[model samples]
Target: MQWTKLLCNYRELQLVGTLNGGQSFRWTYNKDTDEWIGVFSKTAWKLRQKDDYLEYQVLGSLLPEFSGNNTQIKNGNAKTCEESIFKSLLEKYFRLDVNLGSYYKEWSAKDELFKSACQQFYGIRMLNQEPVENLFSFICSQNNHISRISSMVEKLCTHYGEEICHHEGITYYAFPEVEKLSEAKVADCICLMSLNHLKALPVDTHVYQIAAQNYLPHLRGKKNVTEKMYAEIGDHFRLLYGDLAGWAHTVLFCADLKKFQSTDHKKEADEGVKAKKKRRQ
Candidate 1:
C-alpha cells in the first residue's frame, strides 16, 4: 500500500486552532508503510494505494479506489488531477463562487481587523471544505479541546467500524456513518462525547453564537434550545452549500480576526451611544 500525503500542504489545515485545530490531525506519508497515516490523539487512520490510486476513510478505516466497499476515484500518477479534485470539490461543496468578491469587500469594509488578519494569516484567500464531516467534526468539537476531540473521533471510528484493508501493513476507518451516530447511545458516546461542554474554539459554538446573536435573536432568551437548534444551523449551511458545510465551519472557525472586528463594533456602538447622551445633555 502506498500512502499519499494528505492535508499538510493545505494552508487551511495548517493554521492551528483553526477548524478546531486540524493540526491535531498529524498527517504523514509513511514510505516504510507505503501508506498515509493520519494519527489523531486516540485513534489512527491509514490511506493505502490500490491498483492505481490511494484512498482512506475515518469511521470505517482505510480503503482504496479499487476496494469494492468504497466508490471513489483513485488518483496516483495524476498528482495535479488529485489536488485539483480536492480543491474543486472543496469549492463546490461550499458554494464559494457565490458573490464571494462582494462578500470579501463587505467584510473588508466592516471588519478591517479581519481583512488585515486574513492577509497576514492566510495571504488574503478563502479556503473552503466539505459539509458532512465538517458538521460532525464541529459537533465533536463542542466543549472539547483539540487533542481530546481528535482522540474521541478516532475512538468512535475504531469502536464501531470496518477496516479498509489495502496493502499488507496499512489500514484505516472511514468517518462514522450517520446511521452509527443516529443509533449511538449517550452512554456509548459519553466515553467520547463532549456535547455542550462549550469550548472557546468549537466551530459549532462559534457559529451557534454568531447566528444566535445575529440571526435568531429570540433564541437568546429562550430556555429550551434543543439539539434541534444546533442541527438546524448545521442544516442551514448544508442546504445552502451542498458540499461546503465543512468549509463554512472552517471559515467561521478560523475567522479569529473577526473576533477583533466584533470587539471593535461593540466599542463603536458604545461610543456612539455615549456621544448621543452627551449631545442630549
Candidate 2:
C-alpha cells in the first residue's frame, strides 16, 4: 500500500482525539500499527500522523470516483485523479480549511476556563461528517455510551449500507444513504455536530452540567434540562463563544469526559515514566 502525506501539524489536527473522542463512531484505533482504520466517503482509510504531516492509505478497492471532470481519467491519469479525490474528501472531512489554532487562541482569550482546558486538550476540531450518518449515529447516542453507540452504528452499516470490502477479517461498508433508510429519524444536534453549523449548540447532559457548574448556577440541582433551559444554555454559549460556539462547546465537552481524563492522565504518566527511565539510562 502506498502512503500519501497530508500537510497538517499536531496543533491543527490530533487524529486520536478528533476521531475517537465522541465525534464519529466509525473509526477504530489499531494499537499495534498506531493507525486509525475507518470507512468514510464510501471508502476505507488507514491514517496516521508523523510530526507535522498525516500519512494515509486507502485500504480497499472501493475508491470514490472523480465526479468533477472525467477528462483526467480519460486522459490516462486515473490513479492521480483518484488520489486527488481521496485527498479532497479527507480535507473536507477534517475541515482542514479551518484554522484550528486561531480558533483555539480566540476561544482561550474569551474564556479562562476554556484557556485552561486547551492546555491539555489541544487540536480537538469538529469533523464535517456525512449528515445522514451523523443523524443516525447521534440518534443512537441518545441515553447511550460510546461503546454501545459504536456497536449500533456498526450494525446499521453492516445491515443497511453497501459492503465496500473485507480487510483483516473485518468487512467495511459505506454509510447508508437517505433513500435506503426508510425508518430513519432526525436530530437537531446533528446539524451542529456534522453539518458545519458551528454556531448551533446542542445542549445535552454534559453541556448542561458544564453550564450549571460554571456559566449558569441556576441550572444546578435541576433534575432535567427543560426546553426553556436548553434554549437558555444554547444562547449563553453563543453569547460566550460567538459564531463557533458549537466548536468551543465540543472542546469543553471532551475536556469534561471521564474517558478523556483517565486516558490522557495515563498516557501522560506513561510518557513521564519513559522520560525518567531515559534520563536515568
Candidate 3:
C-alpha cells in the first residue's frame, strides 16, 4: 500500500452553485506523515498512512489493480506507480494550475471594493474542477441551502459512483459520469429538494443571483434566467482570472456578508418600533 497524500483539487467543486462548494478541502500538504484529508460525502476522509509511503485510494477502480500484497508493498516501498488514466482525467476533467496573485491584482485593480473585500476576507482562488460534473452538481444546488447541497452530492456519489476501499474503515466514491446522470431518471435521484427542480436549475448561484439583481446589465431575459447566462458569467470570470471562477464566487458570497447585517438591522428595527409603541401608550 503506497502512502502519499494525493491532493484532489478541483475548482468545479468550489463553483458558486456546486453541491460541494467549499475550499477547505484544498489544503496544505503534510510532508512528514504524507497523509491528507478532504471533505466528501459531508464528512472528511483521511488518506491511509503507511511506513515509507502514503497512498490515496483513487476513489473508483479508475486504475488497474496493484500486483503486490501488503508484505510486498511494504518491502518494496517504491513510489506508487502513476495511473495514466488518472493523469489523463486530471487533465481532461479539471482546470488545475492558476496564477491567483495575477488574477487578484487584475480584479482588484478594476474595483476598489473588490480589493477591500479580499483584504478583509483573505480570499483564495479555486482550481481543478471538471465542467460537466460542475454542471450537474450545480443543478443539484438550486434554491437549496449548503447543508442539503452537501447531502445531495453525497447521495449522487454513493448511489452512482464506483467505490474503492483503503483502510479497514474508510472508503471513497468517485463522481459519476455525465451519461449516467443524463440517462438517469433525474426526478428519482433529485427532489425539490425535488428532482423536477433539478432539471430546470443552472450551475452557478452567484451568476443567477447577480443576474437577478441586475449586477450585470448586459444580460437580459424574460422572467427566469437561463443556464447559458450563468455559464456565460462563469466563462467571463474564467477568461479574466483563468481558473478563479470558484474563488470569485467565494469572494462575492463573502462580500454579501451584509445579509447578516440586514438580519441585525431587522432586529433593531423591531425593537425600536416596540419601544415607540410603549412610549405612545
After superposition, candidate 3 runs with Cα above 4 Å error = 1-36, 39-61, 65-96, 120-123, 166-168, 183-250, 254-281
Ranking by lDDT: 2, 3, 1
lDDT of 2 at 82: 78
Report the C-alpha lDDT of model 2 over 1-281, residue by residue, as the tens digit.
56888888766887767887888999998877778999888777889976578888776534445445434432434476577877888999998999999989998998999998887678888899888889889889989999999999999899989877667788889888888775554455688777778899887888899999998998899999899999999999899999889988888888888887897655963564476457558
Name the better of 1 and 3 by TM-score. Answer: 3
TM-score of each: 0.42, 0.88, 0.49
Which lDDT tens digits does candidate 3 get at residues 1-281?
33334343321122221212342222223445544544332222345323222234333243333334323322334333534433444333223344445666777876565676554333243333444444565566567665666668767877986664443455556567677787423331232122222112223445456544534566645355565775666565555444334455456555554542366534643554475457558
The candidate with the higher TM-score, 1 or 2, is: 2
Among all candidates shown, the one with the greatest lDDT: 2
Worst 10 residues of 1 by lDDT: 191-200
Alpha-carbon error at 71 in model 3, in Å?
10
Instruction: Give one digit per residue, the lDDT tens place, for model 1 in 92-141.
Output: 32233454444444444554443554442331222232233334555575
Weakest 10 consecutive residues of candidate 2 by summed lDDT: 69-78
Which is the winner by lDDT between candidate 1 and candidate 2?
2
